[model samples]
Target: MESAVEQLLHSGTIIPAHPLALDQYRRLNENRQRLLTRYYIASGVGGVAVGVHTTQFAIRRPDINLLEPVLRIAAEEIAAAGLERPFIKVAGICGPTEQALAEARLALKYGYHIGLLSLGGLTAHTEAELLAHVRAVADVIPVFGFYLQPSVGGRILSYEFWEQFVEIPGVKAIKTAPFNRYQTLDVVRAVASSSRRNNIALYTGNDDNIVADLLTTYRFHVNGEIVEKGFAGGLLGHWSVWTEKVTGLFGRIKNCILEDYKGAGALLQEGIAVTDMNAAIFDPSHAFRGSIAGIHEVLRRQGLLEGTWCLEDHEVLSPGQTAEIDRVTAAYPHLTDDIFVKEFLSQDSIKKLLLHA
Candidate 1:
């Protein structure tokens, strides 16, 4: 890993899985997409993950062919920002080995810092086959392993799979989003046992358990030594909405760790509040059928998106989901970044930021 990239990853920061911005026709909305990128950069996110689950996997369809375009837009925006510090850019790579390698190369072409490799769709492969696929992609660019929850299109990867995963020299980080505690522990312990344990950063993808994951230290007895690990930060769909607040929350969590704060009571309460908001936005009542749309709805409500449009017409919010969003927005107004977004949009230099040079 490049020194800067390695430093940032280990230090931990908020990385929102960038969402797709589409017109009513379900075509890419370049202007709004650019604006969304500016919003994230302005909101203090350390990085952005494009072409990921929140961006909609359907965009890769030949007829749509949005993978490169979306990646390019984000790359342009980040470059245009010209931040003095390193800003990690993560491009999501999916599909079988051949396609995953192609996407990894494409990500490197666009100046992405890492490829967030999703093994969700390859359900039939054996663990050995899966590891081979992972190694093939990592051979192209550094890899961020994704343990997507089975509720989505993900399969249950054994601890053995991750044990081998962390041993790969090109593996840089892992985002554990199994949404299951036991499964999350599996990934953590696997890394803990690896020779490169310190080299691989563990980021929490568990939206339901974000605060706790960030706060609790994971200790393991490995090879006659005690190893401690904790989530450095999150690469989350939940963080994609209310981003400014999300950054603030992460900073507070970081402070707790650095100060060795003993007060868990208040932080635990905040975690429940965040999880409650996630339920509303993630729409767990419908098995996450509305997950992407739920995220779009929040952005749309904040004027970050035009509408809750998705590539597939049937992918709209589940019935009663809008009401649930309404409930949470009303219930936890502090968690939303509406005011920050409003002021950001009103800035005199907004036009310059949105210009497609």
Candidate 2:
């Protein structure tokens, strides 16, 4: 990794899993897509992860062919912003070795800083096969391992799998989102056991336990030494919506770490509130069938998107999911950024920002 990129990655910042913006016809809404990128930048995200799960992996299908286009759109928007500080660009890399390698190359071509390698589809492969797959892509670009929850398309990756994963020379970080406490600890302990542990960053993808993951410290005894690790930040789907509030919440969490603050009572309460909101937005009730549409609904309601239309007609919200969303928005008004987004859309300067090529 470049020194600056490595610095920002380790320093801990909010990186939202960028979503795909589409028209009612389910075509790429380039203008709305660019506008969404602008919203993330304006909302103070440290970076954006494009072509990831939140963006819908279906985009990579041969018939759809949206992976490169979406990646290029985000890259262009980031470049047009001309940020003074380093901003991490993570491109999601999926499929087998050959395809994953091709995606990595494409991501690098577009100036992405890291490849978030997803192992969800390769569940049938042996651990050794999976490791080889990881190394092939890692050799092409710095990698961020993803442990997607199985409730979606993900399969369960064992601790043994992650133990070897951390040893890959090009692996730079891990986004632990198994949504299982035991599995999350496995990633932490695996990194702790590595000689290059300090070089690797751990980020929480557990939207259900975002606050607690950020607040707790994971300590392990390795080589008769105490090795402590905590989530540097999050690379989350939940953060993709209500990002301004997410940034502020992350700032407070980071401050708590810096000060070694002991008063976590209030923060823990906030965590429950966040989990409640996530249940509504993530639709945990229906095994996350509505997760993507749930995200779109929030953006649509805020006018960042035209509507909650997904590429597949069957991918719409689950029955009563909208009512659940309504309940959370009304219940946790502080968590939503409706006012911030409204003000942002009204700004003449933002209009000019969106006009950039």
Candidate 3:
């Protein structure tokens, strides 16, 4: 494992949403992207995951191709931020093996450190086929396996699939975001059982179980001795919203773990408020119609976003989602770090981005 990736992967990573100009649909708002990168770096997040689902990868089609531009500007923004610690810049990779590897190479060219491989485009694939796809991509650069939820068009992988995944050369990490306990454990167990177990880092992408997942100490016998394991950290869409506060919470949790503090119950309890806010935003009632909108609304409130607009008109907040956002903001006062982003917000940039607003 590369020392840089090993160092950066051992902490929480935030996935920032692509901020569009207030009224312009499908536009990549570069100024806001810079500000977001600045804020995320200031908040002490260990890394950033861009071009992922949270950034609405759906918009990066062959015609428009926002992927390269977004990654380039983000690198520029990171240089502007002058961060001391190296941030793990991640590029989300999808489609077939050839396309995915091409994207991975582009990401590396644009200063991204790892490819968060999403096997969404290759539908009706077998485990062997998927394994081949990942190995081919990994041949070019380091890779992270993603078990995205079905709700978001993510194909669920079996433990058998994960076991094979962990053994793949250059498969450096796994983001377990199945949104199901059994599936989450399947990935964890796969890592635990792999011959290259020590070489692979496990990160939780299970937003609903973020805190508990971090607190858990998974014990298993990897060799003659009993080997213990746990998630090194998280890479979450949920973290994009309340970022600074979320970063602080992550620090506190990690501190407790280091000190072996006995307040596991209280630590897990803190997740409920965040989960409540997630429920409102990720509203299961509407199948998350407002999920992205709800995220934008939070950022808009913080001045990280220009407005709650999306690429597709129907991508706007679900009905009553604005009210739900309001309710969570009121109910979870401590959960927000709006002032953090607001403190450094550029009204001049906002005005330039949205002339009529």
Candidate 4:
């Protein structure tokens, strides 16, 4: 079967970056010299999730006036990781138009080639005003518009609204996290088939369907021969491409899709199964338990992340659940880290340290 990795090699690219925080934003400018040097270092780059910080509901990370620190870290990390230019996603904060403009200016100053702006609190009634504000920022630096879904945050955008947004200059890519698989596929078809081409890259933020959407489906093509099957190309949920297991799989899948579609389809099914099992550890209610954190926790269980740990708010496997993950991890073998579950700390110990339940 073709893994997501294989399919990606043939169709498109993946860019990965760490989240940015207000407190750490200063590092962007201060670390510029070092980061710039490091950016050119031989690297392996994937997708980056910048702008937003993860914390338990109680405490949000600190905010900084400038985003240079975070951008510097991101550019350096992506460069070091051997990825192409890193992409940035703006985190939404309650503020006046001045604050929004400041964030846009930060993005421009830091050399972020791509941007995803989350305007959650901005109302539809103010949609025209927001677009004008976004355009003002875009004049300085390019930007992507994302209507963050209710699952993450309520509806900040609508299809009619986005149709208007796509008209803005420098509005290149969009990260769409739809309510379900069908809605996701619908959006992909719409964007890929849209009249506007160059400034728009359709990114599927819908975790469950990323593999299938990118690796199997056929969007419209000018050539009549074989409608190319596979991802519209943007970003997958964190875990889908985070670890070597999933990332490696995607790398392989990229190549396989162009050579053999059937093979890629099979690999995607397997990948989804592994992801499903991982998500199941948290709860049946939550479809995806934040992919990065989940993968980090699983890796933590096997002792791969080493001193690194899953951030707070990350759903953890309970003591009773540990044996299950251990068993599943062993059965899969693809996620192997060769550590005895017996030696590891209990779920209670892990939970207490990770975040209050």
Best of the candidates, TM-score: 1
lDDT of 3: 0.77
User: Residue-wise lDDT of candidate 3 within 1-357, one digit each (tens)?
Assistant: 457656667544444433433336556666666666666777777778888877776657776677787788778878776766667888888888778888888988987778899987567888899999999999987898898888877887788888888999788888888789988888888888888888888888887888888888888876677777788888777877778898778877888888886777788888888788887777767976777778878887766677887766677777788788889899888888867666555456545543433
Candidate with top lDDT is 1
TM-score ranking of the models: 1, 2, 3, 4
- In order, candidate lDDTs are 0.91, 0.90, 0.77, 0.47
* TM-score (C-alpha, index-matched) for candidate 2: 0.97
Query: If the candidates were sorted by their lDDT against the true structure, best first, what order would they fall in?
Result: 1, 2, 3, 4
lDDT of 4 by residue, 253-279 (tens): 666766867587577777676555655
Q: Tell me each candidate's TM-score.
A: 0.97, 0.97, 0.92, 0.65
Q: Weakest 10 consecutive residues, lDDT, candidate 4? A: 20-29
- Deviation in Å, model 2, residue 48 alpha carbon: 0.5
Off by over 4 Å in 2: 349-357
Query: What are the per-residue Cα lDDT tens digits for candidate 1 across 144-225?
Result: 9999999998989888999999999999999999999999999999999999999999999998999999998999999899
Query: What is the RMSD, in Å, between candidate 1 and the native fold over all Cα?
Result: 1.5
Candidate 1 clashes between residue pairs 3 or more apart in a chain or in different chains? none
Tens digits of per-residue lDDT for model 2 on 1-357? 678878989988899999998877889888888889989999999899999988998999889999999999999989999998889999999998889999999999999999999988787898889999998888899999888888776877778888899989999999998899988988899998898798899999998999999999989999999999889999999999999999888888888777886557777899999999999888888988898999999999998888998887778899999999999999999989999999998989667644641
- What is the alpha-carbon lDDT for the whole of candidate 4? 0.47
